[model samples]
Target: MQSDKPSFVFTGWHMLAAMLLFFGTIITVNFTMAYLATSTWSGLVVKNTYIASQEFNGKAAGIRAMLSTGIKGTLAVKDDSIRYGLAMPGDKPVLADKVTAHFKRPVGEHQDFVTELEPAGAGVYEASRQVLPGNWIVEIIAVKDGETIMHEANRIAVTGEGK
Candidate 1:
């Protein structure tokens, strides 16, 4: 006669070791990811605000130069907000009274995205302009201490929900 019982393939010691290893790895990875994520988020928020503040004119001017070359650069649309950047060269950045973006609608009407920006530092000025869905032409003008220094233009395409 033979009696049947479930076999214990893994001993308690082995199970405990495996569980410790697995949970340790999981916790380590989670902590590392959280740290990276927090750092990145803070950096982005500060950058955006700096750009919007119009403080870094030199940096911002350089960005304008890059975009005017008809090459796609740092401008992007995020959740109904248009984010663009520029860099100017000098000891300081210029704050502008107004930056006007001139574009033509697909139907041939003209539109403008305009704003005044605050200075962020290192010659970078940042601002945001509301934009509609369609093709766009972009231009920026900078005036600092009552002097105009840079102006350039480019084209872009905008697409998303409600554009």
Candidate 2:
């Protein structure tokens, strides 16, 4: 005589459930680690890049300092307008609330001229006028918080007359 006994056998559903749980946990953990690593590395890269870029720009600005003063590179002329660049010294960039550019005839009366308000960002302004150009003076005034601050690079001349 033999005793009746049953042996435990895993069904397809049991194997499927176990596989699903194992893979689900693995995928979730992988995603979490990836997210954290990416966020950390991206932040570090941004900070480092900003510092390095400022250093490079400082070096370039030093070389460019001479061009803004002497002949040839000092002037900014256009067909119908003129623009000049204003930069703050050191590593920091210029940020002004208001910038004004005034163009006038150097030798003649200053009545026949144009003045324009410049935007922020780059701090440049241009006022166009239809006048026979021989020699004109340009004045740039930058203001912040209702007070006049930086002003330089004056006495720019417009050379040729228009057709």
Candidate 3:
């Protein structure tokens, strides 16, 4: 005669198995997310933080001075080009003899570019570029006497298709 009965009691092996599965899933997910974040990150906001910090005060003062002088600018996107316009208080639209446009993508540095604008009219400048539709940080630098006389930086919304 043999006794046949199913055991329904909890055991150490069962507890160990459940714990292993629970912790394994958590560890796997954490590692995967960490890998993806590091791989996509560009790192470093500035090459030398100390130098940038040193120049920060002067830059702020210069911007304030330029603002009071009634220097104004606008940026627009056209067909594979960016139309820039400058408004100065004097006779000419551009206050400086040389004007350059600098574009930077906030998310990454690889998309950063610079182009010198050709005078389209008295106050208008035209520069052609293949710009992707997103947030763009623009700086219009006006140079005179071999130095940057005035600069304006603003964020612009770019629409339309991107390549």
Candidate 4:
């Protein structure tokens, strides 16, 4: 007499089911990662890539000319403002005709901001605005005689430790 228990057998149907489950899992994981990555991603900075590429050399030349001038500067982030301190070849502090600060987030463009830093004093420019505490790429520009006399960029972290 044979027992009523059915013998379990590996067959084509089992193989097909396993393959579907494996492929389905991979597809689901790939989609999930793609979704999470785009939330804070930022694309190209240049509006027109072709134009930017064509004018890249000219822009570099202008920046080089600006750096040739013996000027130095420092930027500090404050609770209510960003301070820019500049100096010429001499130890004396000097203020350019126009000064601006461009702040951009490392990961995304949503929090990026650009504003002219007002004259605080001799060789000092300040922009009064609260900045979110995190990573930032700062570009400081000083314009003199209708030309950019200096351009400087630096990466910094703003921790709300003191605040």
Candidate 5:
């Protein structure tokens, strides 16, 4: 004898609903990710790719020449003070007339600023500035006699403590 209760059956409508739900969820997620990716970052590293490519070899040679000078640089950020130091192999100070530090955010240029560090001592330069808490890309250039003697780039993370 059969029971009075009706049994469940899988029909075309159920299949259609399931397929729609699966595809709809995937499409929704894809659209969301695409929007976020495009809206958040511009993904531009240089203003002109062709010009940058043309100058790449010269920049590489300049970097090699700078490295051969055996000058080492150190950067420190603490309590609204940004300090940079340059030294040789035996801790001897490097002779440079001017030093500049270009601070920029990795994703945007709104917070970018260039600070000309004044000489505090032998091969030491410093500036008093409050860096925001986030990721930064810093490019340091040391000029001596109208020529760049040392050029370096570094990535740093600033925390709430400014370290």
Candidate 6:
């Protein structure tokens, strides 16, 4: 008994189409990811690697010395105001002649700014500046009698609602 309907067959063209679709999807995804990565971040940590390497040990030693003092810092961002405070091991206020903060974006320097904080109280410093909500790398420096007492870097996320 011969039926009128004919069975379908998978031919070379079908195989070629399958391979093309598979490879095309993969290539498209790769190109999109590469473009996004290059466009977002410049991937630059330092201008000169050799100079940074040479100073690494000295910076490490300075950080160790700074930590030995058992000084702690606090940062508060509210609306357009930035506040910083320093305390000793026993929670005593650390008085400093000058306090400055360097705020930088993690991926770019376009939004970076340095502001000197005014003394609000014993160990409290405050600055009125508008910082956009995003990730920030803050470097706080406190100097007393022209000598650095505290030098610390901290990473913080600023949300839409300042707190």
TM-score for all models, in order of appearance: 0.39, 0.43, 0.79, 0.86, 0.86, 0.82
Candidate 3 structure quality by residue, lDDT tens digits, 1-163: 7668876989999999999999999999999999987777667788899999999999898878878878677778766887877777664576457789888887777778899887888777887778888898988887768877668888987877842
Poorly placed runs, candidate 5 (over 4 Å): 2-6
lDDT string, candidate 2, 47-112, tens digits: 577778879877566447634533121236667655545554542345557766656554445344
lDDT of 5 by residue, 39-60 (tens): 8788998899999999999999
For candidate 4, write residues 104-144 as lDDT tens digits: 98888878999899888888999888888989999988887
Per-candidate total of colliding backbone pairs = 33, 0, 0, 0, 0, 0
Give the poorly placed runs of model 2, Cα more than 4 Å off: 1-75, 90-92, 126-131, 161-163
State which candidate, 3 or 5, has the greater lDDT: 5
What residue pairs are clashing in model 4? Answer: none
Q: Which digits, one per residue and each the tens of the lDDT, describe model 6 over residues 28-53?
A: 99999999998888899889999999
Q: Rate the local accuracy (lDDT) of all candidates.
A: 0.56, 0.57, 0.80, 0.86, 0.92, 0.93
Look at candidate 5 and tell me the lDDT of residue 49: 100
Which residue ranges in model 3 land beyond 4 Å of their true spot? 1-7, 89-92
Q: TM-score of predicted model 2?
A: 0.43
TM-score for predicted model 4 compared with the true structure? 0.86
Which residue segments of model 1 deviate by more than 4 Å?
Answer: 1-77, 88-100, 103-107, 110-113, 120-122
lDDT of 2: 0.57
* Candidate 3, pairs of clashing residues: none
Q: Can you list the residue pairs that collide in candidate 6?
A: none
For each of the candidates, the C-alpha root-mean-square deviation to the true structure, in angstroms, is 15.7, 19.1, 3.5, 2.6, 2.1, 2.4
Better of 1 and 4 by lDDT: 4
